[model samples]
Target: MFFFQGLTMGLAYVAPIGMQNLFVIHSALSHSLRRAIMTAFIVIFFDISLSLSCFYGIGTLLDHVTWLQAVILGVGTLLVLYIAYGMIRDIPAPISLKDQPASLRQTMSKACIVTWMNPQAILDGTMLLGAFRVTLPAAESTPFLTGVLLASGLWFLSLTGFVAAFRHAMTPRILRAINVLCGTVLMLYGLHLGYTFVQFFQI
Candidate 1:
């Protein structure tokens, strides 16, 4: 039960405009296959660790410091704003890599930076998921995290693989449509986050 719930929740949380999905999709089409798989693994590593931290560390912190929720909310809100700017400015699409992925050390370095720098992902994977996991009976949390890890890995890997199969179909028109949709959702979600922040802060 915990595993199933975790799998469903993880899929719901991860399928959106987060960095992991973007990297996988981009790499599958444009970067080396091995590099793309490595990126997905890096993302999964972060997700699992973040969830564990939330499970153990954040749960304890929040029990005492009610303001922790606000901090997470603020971080999430800010990320949405930053991404909104990028979308609204119609920033030129990233240049797709024509070269093979970097060596293992270089890939690891880049993956670390990308995984760590994404504030929204950090909050969702560690902070929110952690709190929820802590609420579960201790017997189930391990399986819960296992389910989440599997979901995260599968989502990214399958996303990249499926998109790669259609590499030629990712025309400019398609990319533009995706950008428009992503930008719209980012702005809407940011506004929602701001509203939630205000509502929770006042309580």
Candidate 2:
């Protein structure tokens, strides 16, 4: 039950695809598989820590901050829009690897930097995902965390393998498709975020 529950929720969280998956695929196909895994581990580390932190800390504190919901919604807006822009801008860079060798340490460091420091990940991991756990029974709370961590691991591993297997398929045209998909999702998410913000402020 935990496995399937984790699998379903994990896919829901990651199904749309995102920047982290993009980089992992890019690295695995062109650079070192070791490097992709290295980076993925870092992402998972931060993701787990953040999930736990939000579950324990932010979820509780948020109730007291009357204005926090609005503030968070606004930040989420900028985040999604900015990611949309980045998806458009960086799509071209995926193929031009500079032939740089993937360094395990470098990949790990980069993933950690992005996941831990990025406001978007923090918001999603804690404010959003963690908040979902607040209403669950105590026995099932463990499953929720399990689901999150399992999702992260599965996403990274599959992403790495997919890219490695289909490196040749990811041509420029395919990248264009990926860019369109990523950009569209980011924009839609941005719109949802804005709507959420407006709902909170009622203006």
Candidate 3:
């Protein structure tokens, strides 16, 4: 039951369009199948690692440290802005299959940064997962964690396949519009996070 519960929570959280999804879709649309798979795996790695850390009580430590929270918020906002800029200014032409500018190592690094630097991701792991973790029996914890990991991994794989399946139908115009939309949303999200951080300071 715990495993199923965790799986459900993971799917619910991951189904929404977010930075990780955006990158995965972009990779699927612009790169080879192998590269897209690699991106998905990289994202899953970060998701699981973060979840595990939070489950082990790291989230509680973070909550007690205002300066660390502020620093994370600041850095996350900046990274979101940077990613939004890339979305707006650096979108490549729609390609069915093309060589990506960065190698696998660079792609993996960017995936890690994007996954780790997003404040939402951190909060999701530390707060949401941590809360759920507290309610579970120690013996069930492993199953629950495995469920979370599986859910995230499956979602990424499905997302990659979904984007890849439709890659041929995406025209340059459509792709450009998608990029613009993603950038606008990301920029707004960053601004909101920044505002929240400032509000905390004011309080």
Q: Which one wins on lDDT?
A: 3
| Model 1 residue 44 CA deviation in Å | 1.6
Alpha carbon lDDT at 28, candidate 3: 84
List pairs with backbone clashes in candidate 1: none
TM-score leader: 3
- When 2 and 3 are scored with TM-score, the better candidate is 3
| Candidate 3 backbone overlaps, count | 0
lDDT of each: 0.65, 0.64, 0.81
Candidate 3 wrongly placed segments (more than 4 Å):
none
Q: Model 2, 154: alpha-carbon shift in Å?
A: 3.0
Q: How well is each residue in 1-203 modelled by candidate 3, as lDDT tens digits? A: 87888899889878898888888887787777888888889888887777788778777777798788888788888878887888887656767565664687777777876777777778877888888877888899988888888899999999999888888888888888878887888888789878877877887
Query: Which digits, one per residue and each the tens of the lDDT, describe model 2 over residues 1-203?
Result: 65466557666765556556655654565555565566667776766676677767665565688687677667667765775676566544454434545466666654654454344555665665666676667787787778777887887777777776676557776766767676677677678768877877774
In terms of lDDT, the poorest run of 10 residues in model 2 is 91-100
RMSD of each: 5.0, 4.9, 1.6
Provide the lowest-lDDT 10-residue window in model 3. 92-101
Better of 2 and 3 by lDDT: 3
Cα error of candidate 1 at position 147, Å: 3.3
The TM-score that candidate 3 achieves is 0.92
| Model 1, span 50-166: residue lDDT tens | 666655665556558777768766766776666655555553343354545546675565454445544456555656686776588989988887777788788878887787667
Better of 1 and 3 by TM-score: 3
